[model samples]
Target: MPGSVIGINMNYGYPGQASRHGDEVSRTRPVATTSEKIMFGAPVVQNTDGSVKAWEAASTAANFAGVAMRKVKAAKIYPYQNFGYYGAGEPCDVLLRGGISVVCAWGTPTIGGTVYVRTNVAEEGSPEEAKIGDFGAEDESGNCIALTNAKWSSSKDERNVAELTILTRQGV
Candidate 1:
C-alpha cells in the first residue's frame, strides 16, 4: 500500500543549503582576520582588502558580498552538530546568485517580498536582542535595512527557515 500525505510542502533542509542544483554561482573567500564568527546562511560583505566579513547594518548595499554557504566538515559529523560557524581567516563559499535556505531571524517571510537585515538590537539586555545578519521581511524603521536585488523565494517553514533568491551579485 502507498503512504498517505498529511501536510503541505515545507522546507526541510539545513540553512545555507541550495534549494536546487546547478543554478547557483559561488565564490571562495577567506574570512577577514578581524571578523567575528559567521554562521552559515548569513549575509556577508567584502572588505577593502578582499576578505569577507559578516554584513553589518552600517554596511552599504555597494559593499554587500553574498550569503555564506554551509560546508561539510569532519567536526560536523551529525546533522544536529552542524550549528558550527566559520571563524576569522577560514575559507568560505559565498553564494553570489542562487536560491538558498536561511533563517528568518524576525518578521514573517513573504514570497517575492523584499528581504531585510536586522541592523540593531531589538531589545536591550534581553534574549530577544537582534543580531547583525539576521534576515526579516519588514524594515522595522531603523532596526532593519533592505537588501538590494534579493527577495524571499518562499515563506518560512515551521523551522523559520525560508528560501532566498539572489537575482544578481551585489557590490561585485
Candidate 2:
C-alpha cells in the first residue's frame, strides 16, 4: 500500500432539491444544454404594440433562479432586474456556473436588508458566503469564482458590478 496513489470517491447531493407549500415538487435546478446558453425566466420580447411581453409561469420563480447547475453554462437572473425590501430577509437565490460566463445582476429590496447567496443565508455564516448591496452583483452560488460582493452601480439608477452592495429601503 505504500507509495501507491489512491483516488478519493465521495457522494454528493444537489442543493435544496425542493420546497414545501403543498404537494412536493423539484425546486428548480436546471442542467446545462450543449448550446452553452442557459436561459432563465421567460421569453421577453418587445411587442409591436410598443409593450414588453414576458412568457413565464407566474409563480415562485420570482424568488428562485431557474438556471442549469452545470459548469460552463451561462445564466441570467432576469427577474431580480427590479428592486425593494424583504423585511424577513427572504434571500434572493441565484444559480452558479463556472468557466466563461456573461451575466447581468439585478434586484429590488423587498425589505430593508441586503442580498446574500450560498452559506450566507441567515442560519448560515459569512466569510465563506456572498454578500452585496441592493442592485449589486454576485456570481452564481455553485459556480462562484469566490464569495463576491454584488458588482453593480448604486442608487438603482446605475448598473455596475461589485463584490457587494447594501439592499436599502429605496428604489430607482
Candidate 3:
C-alpha cells in the first residue's frame, strides 16, 4: 500500500504516548499541480510561493519543505480557502516531524540505519540495483540526502515498504 494510507491516529507522533496521541505535529501547504507522485512518507521541496513538490537533488535546502501527510489531488480546493485548486494547485498537509512514514527499502534497513533519498545513480556496491530512498549504515556516494529522524525496528526487503518516524527536518 502507499504511504498515503494512514492509520486512524493520523496526528500521532512516533512512539507516541497515549496522553499526547492526538496532537498534530504536521502543517498544511499547497502542492504544485504538476507535483510528482508523493507517497505518505516521501520527501518534498517548496517553491518561492510556498507550493510543495517532491524533493529532488537539484533543490537546495531552502526549497525543502517536509513530508507528505495525505494523498492529495492536484487542483482540488481544501476547506480552508481557495488555496488549492486546478491551475492554482492542491493543498497537502505536511508532517514536518514526529510522524511515521512508510518509505521504500533500498536494502535491508536495520533499526538504527540512517535514511537517505537516492539519486539517479546506483549505490557503490549494489551495482545495477538502484538505492534511491534507501536507509543504510553508510553513505558512500555523498549523493544521499539524509532524513535524520527515520529508523527501522525490523529489517525490510529490497523494494519493500517499512514504517519509520520523522525525527527531524534536517535537509541534506
Candidate 4:
C-alpha cells in the first residue's frame, strides 16, 4: 500500500490587513519627510501639519493617528517583498477605526487585552530596541505605552501577527 500525503494551509494574512470590511475607516496621509520607513500595521502619529510619522514616544500618544495600512503596489513582484512599508513622502492609508492585523513584537496577545506600542524607551541593547512600531500586551520594562482606545481582537498566530481593533482616537 502507498502512503497518503496531506496538505496543510499556512496562509497567515499580512500585517495591516483589515480583518473585516465596511466598518473600517481609513484616511490617506503623506508620510512625513523626517519619518522613518513606516511599516504596515505600525502605530503612527500625525505631525502638526498633518503628515504621518511612526510613533516614537508616550508624550505623542495624544496625537496617535492610527496604524499604517498596507496597499497593494504594482512594483512589488513577490508577496513577501519588503514586508510592506512606506518610504518618506509616500501616500499612506491609515486605518483610523477598525480591525487590523499587526505584528506582535513582544509579549503575547490576548483577545480584549489593551494594545501597547513600543516606545523609544525600549532598552537600547535589547531585541525591542528597534521595534518602535510593534505591538505588545504590556509595558516591557516601561518601554511600551497603551493605546487608550485599542484592544486585541485576536491572539497572535504562528506568524506573530494578530488582529487589533481600534475603537476611537483622540482627534480622529
Report the lDDT tens digits of candidate 4 across residue range 50-123.
88887776544577788888888655446664367888999988999988888887778888998887776534
Candidate 2's residue-wise lDDT over 1-172, tens digit each?
7543563532121221111223221122222221122222111112233222221222121222222222222223434322211111122222222111112233332222233333222334323332321121333443212223122222222232222221121111
Off by over 4 Å in 2: 1-37, 40-57, 61-70, 73-159, 162-172
Worst 10 residues of 4 by lDDT: 3-12
TM-score of each: 0.86, 0.19, 0.58, 0.84
- In model 1, what are the clashing residue pairs, if there are any? none
Model 1, CA-based lDDT: 0.80
How does residue 141 of candidate 3 score in lDDT?
A: 62
What ranking emerges by TM-score with the best candidate at the front?
A: 1, 4, 3, 2
Scored by lDDT, model 3 comes in at 0.51
Supply every candidate's count of residue pairs whose N, Cα or C atoms clash at under 3 angstroms.
Answer: 0, 33, 5, 0
Q: List runs of model 1 lying over 4 Å from the truth.
A: 1-9, 76-81, 124-129
**lDDT score for residue 122 of model 2:** 33
Clashes (candidate 4): 0
TM-score of 4: 0.84
Would you list the C-alpha lDDT of every candidate in the order shown? 0.80, 0.24, 0.51, 0.78
CA displacement after TM-score superposition, residue 50 of candidate 3 (Å): 1.7
Q: After superposition, how far is residue 55 of candidate 1 from its true place, in Å?
A: 1.9
